[model samples]
Target chain A: MKKRTILGVRACTWVWLIMMGLTLVTYLIGQLGLGGISASLTVLAFALIKGQMLGDYFMGLKRISGFWRWPVVIWLFLPGGLISVAFTLVG
Target chain B: MQAQAVAEPIRYPPGDLAIWVFILAELAAFGAFFGAYAFTRMQHVELFNHFQATLDRDAALINTFALITSSYFVVRAVASIRDNNSQGCVRWLMAALVMGALFLIVKAQEYAHHIDEGIRLSTNTFYMFYLSLTFFHFMHVIMGMVILAAVAVKAKRGGYSATEHTGVETGASYWHMVDLVWLILFPLVYVMK
Candidate 1:
């Protein structure tokens, strides 16, 4: 009967709904034939946001201090940045 | 700042530390694979784009929703156990397994389509990476489901409590990792152009 509620709803539920929303956005982009740096950045940005939310919320890494939180963030950004660079090169 | 930091006790993350390390290692490997994929596409943007269109975006989209929804279920499972609701936890975990099954079913159909079209690893570079990366991830989904099943069985038998549900957290963490990777994988392999 215990729950971590935020704004009257459980935190995980909120995170899940937002994740679904972001996913729909990306799906729309693909369906609309969006491309180029703007679209790429938009998609990558959504992806990065979703990944972080999953880590911090679902993975329970948001509260902990020190080195634990860095791994997921670093892992996401490092590859993400490189991937972005790669996409930008497709001129 | 030091006083505030000291005021809040330094609690470790919910799951076992070892799993987090393992998750990090897995992320590193997948990161390398993603980087390799993106850079590889740089050389053949046209071919990549061409064949990329051949992919079933609708299916990929469905799989994305499946994995994301499953992660949510796993999150709820962990939440349920945190409240000492064994039956609720098991239910949520089983729900997650169902989503994972849906993903595999859709993915298999997509593969069957590819195979029917005479697609093979040797078909082309794009198909090679597509098959290899996806198949690798496909196997992980299977592994994740197995872990969830074991955890669900244990939970059903009253093997865990509010204070001792590390097993649930561990399995949930692994499943979330699978979901997190797909977050990037979907955009990178299927959506990005």
Candidate 2:
């Protein structure tokens, strides 16, 4: 195995573990029935964090040190912000 | 006098630029749908809340884990291919495919239950968004499976190498996109109160 491949595998393993932990945490938060504005924002925050991890690690965006990084970040915030706003207004 | 030299940037997007374009388009479409869902929910807060209560949160939670685990498996598959281990890559991808199949089976059962309960697309605004968003995502999962299956078959046939495994990366990128969508969709549609 190449050196880079070894390093890549190790990095991805750690990211995957973190993502799983976050998923469980998000589910537990939802189960708390913290309804209304706070719950919505917190859930959206979890969604954004998970999505960013997938993009950076699994999608290999973190390796790229150019303008390519911004697109994924923008992609995450756009919908997240919109949903947050909607939830707040409805509440 | 001597001319000065400059170094080029040392970064490139993963898999293929074409796929990133496709990923962006898919995300945009989903974002629009989610925005619309939020808008519709705001307009009919009571209706959305009442029907949202009817959704199977347990099933959604289970599906969430399935996708997250599958995504991890895909990462492993990509790592295997990166090391030029074709057989290992195939095995990892096959495992991911099984998880994807599990997701589809669970989703199919959920759909069956809805159908049995006479929950059509026109049932209500909430159900409309529910069925539309989830079923849309359901199809994406199947599509991602097909892509992964192809990658796995190619890898099994020794079509990829450490230096030329872009196919595996491409498929992994699309699969991760599917997982990303579900990560957001699960909370917005299922867990949000």
Candidate 3:
């Protein structure tokens, strides 16, 4: 598995930092008690993106062409979409 | 907004094919559980939100960070072994193991708090789901750490090389799956209301 580097730092390092940042953002949202469908969607959006990055970069699925790469992405979006719908029905 | 790949050869999925199959199965099981939670919460919004407030979000936030960082450490381990640096690989694995241990410790504290409150799986709907879902994931972290330990011991024994370190990838893939699940689990269980 060839790891891509950016300006000397490994790509995984960058991904890790971004993931941490996103986690904090979600935490802040929770801490602020932001109640609404939008806030829930925002949190789920962050989580799904983090899952995608973990699958692609950390799991090394990015380097692969097809099949395997799609499953994780599908796994991510499938539940995410369903969960979002579930939340929206809170109308 | 992502960068292009460095135009390397088509690498197969980092780990064995069998592992991916197992991973998909695990994901399906988790997906079902999450779906159940979402629907159940929909039916009992007040109950869910009330119990969700009782949870310690700070500990969950810390655990989320711990798991993400540990996943990165595993990525480094894979890279190190790809360079045939078994020692570096071992070091990274050990770092990952430490992070895993940290996650467990924090989670254990959360569980202790719950137990002290006399919370049980039969306590209420929210507590049942909370305890069952989280404890299930907790066992996974424990199992993931054990897998990483085994891989680190193998690396220290010089059992892998640049071309033969699928074992590392396999372990990493498993760990990342655990992390991936937590990525959803944290926000789903702890944050979203």
Task: Name model 2 segments beyond 4 Å from true.
Answer: A1-9, B1-10
Report lDDT (CA) for all predictions. Answer: 0.92, 0.87, 0.90
Cα TM-score of candidate 1? 0.95
lDDT of 3 by residue, B117-160 (tens): 99999999999999999898899899999999999999999999
Q: What are the per-residue Cα lDDT tens digits for candidate 1 across A1-91?
A: 6567888998889999999999999999998989888998899999999999999998888987887868899999999999999999885
Candidate 1, residues B32-93, lDDT tens digits: the string is 99999999999988889899999999999899999999999999899889888999999999
- Residue A44's lDDT within candidate 1 is 92
Ranking by DockQ: 1, 3, 2
- Candidate 3 local lDDT, A33-87, one digit each (tens): 9867999999999999999898888887777885666899999988898889888
Lowest-sum lDDT 10-residue window in model 1 chain B: B1-10
Ordered from best to worst TM-score, the candidate numbers read 1, 3, 2
- Alpha carbon deviation, residue A44, candidate 2 (Å): 1.0
Better of 1 and 2 by DockQ: 1
The candidate with the higher lDDT, 1 or 2, is 1
TM-score of each: 0.95, 0.92, 0.95
RMSD of each: 2.7, 3.6, 3.8
